[model samples]
Target: MQEERRVVFIGKIPSRMTRSELRHRFSVFGDIEECTLHFRSEGDNYGFVTYRYAEEAFAAIESGHKLRRPDEQPFDLCFGGRRQFCRRNYADLDSNREDFDPAPVKSKFDSLDFDTLLRQAQRSLRR
Candidate 1:
């Protein structure tokens, strides 16, 4: 059976760091498919990174991922899994209570009678 992979969430990556550098550091643990550096239209930076496999992704999480120069102090790092990937952490499971069910979704189809719609349309045209 194919191994289930986890999607790791990484934050606090350095703003000035290049993609190549990010790949090199992360590749030491596993294959990295992509690395994106988010930036606001106003030019402020937000740190984010995604990994190809769960094992390497976990290593990165344990490495105390931070937004800093190699010799600098480490910043806060947050690593979590994606729901689609079937990855769940302790915190994720704990937050949801069994007694609290979400509201039933509304149907997508229009339930109003056609005659009512036609009358509304006619009234708008007359106005």
Candidate 2:
């Protein structure tokens, strides 16, 4: 079987969370080749994150947290593909970053019930 390419989606990170900061946070799980932190306006503060591998991506997704904003709404999580990797574009490393929106945060997700997700991932991984 092929090694699954993991693509995790971390949305609604505090607008204050910088790309560097996000990289640091996620890096705790595993190696993160690249990370982009999206921003809304100057300080509206909402965006998404993506990781390179599946295990690291999954670990990040499992660690749930409420948005740092006043409303403190919970956001969704998942993974996606790196555009450059698909195109085999070795020349334009920055192209992928350009396509990534660091603001508004991805809206769609597997509900906000993190407990359910944790149980599911834990159960599935054990098998």
Candidate 3:
């Protein structure tokens, strides 16, 4: 099986940082497939840099490359796994009751009668 591409999570990133700047900074370590910065309105912003090769991602972490600005403290870096990134944290999971169950999703199409569906399709065509 092919090895999965590596992603590095950078925490405490400045909200003003741009994709180009991140790409330039990590490019020295290896070819970067993508760089994404997640900006939050009420919390600290973070970013993820994906490398084309897994070795390059490991090297970048091992080298201790810090993302710092002229007068700001350096940002922290760590290897990010897909599961860790996607899964909810312990605190969030624990807040919910053990018996909690999400309501079944109902599709709009399923609830609409044939006449309503036909009218909606006609209205869409008019636009």
Separately for all candidates shown, the number of backbone clashes (residues 3 or more apart, or on different chains) is 0, 8, 0
Q: Rate the local accuracy (lDDT) of all candidates.
A: 0.58, 0.59, 0.74
Off by over 4 Å in 3: 84-127
Tell me the tens digit of each residue's lDDT in model 1 across 1-127: 2234444554544566666776676677677766665544454444445666767767777774543467644644455434444544323443436775555677643677889888988999999
- Error of model 1, residue 19, in angstroms: 1.9
Best by TM-score: 3
Model 3 scores a C-alpha lDDT of 0.74
Query: lDDT by residue for model 2 over 1-127, one digit each (tens)?
Result: 2234565566666655677876776677777766666665544443344555677767777763532346645656665444535545434444436665544556545465888778988999999
Please give the distance, in angstroms, between residue 109's alpha carbon in candidate 1 and its true position after superposition: 25
Candidate 1 structure lDDT: 0.58
Give me the runs in candidate 1 sitting further than 4 Å from their true place.
1-5, 41-44, 66-75, 80-127
Q: Write the per-residue lDDT of candidate 3 for residues 1-127, one digit (tens) a residue.
A: 2245488887777777787887788778898887888777765777888888999988777764454667655777788646544446433442336876656789979988999999999999999
What TM-score goes with each of the models? Answer: 0.46, 0.47, 0.58
The best candidate in terms of lDDT = 3
Error of 3 at 91 (Å): 13
Off by over 4 Å in 2: 1-5, 42-52, 64-75, 82-127
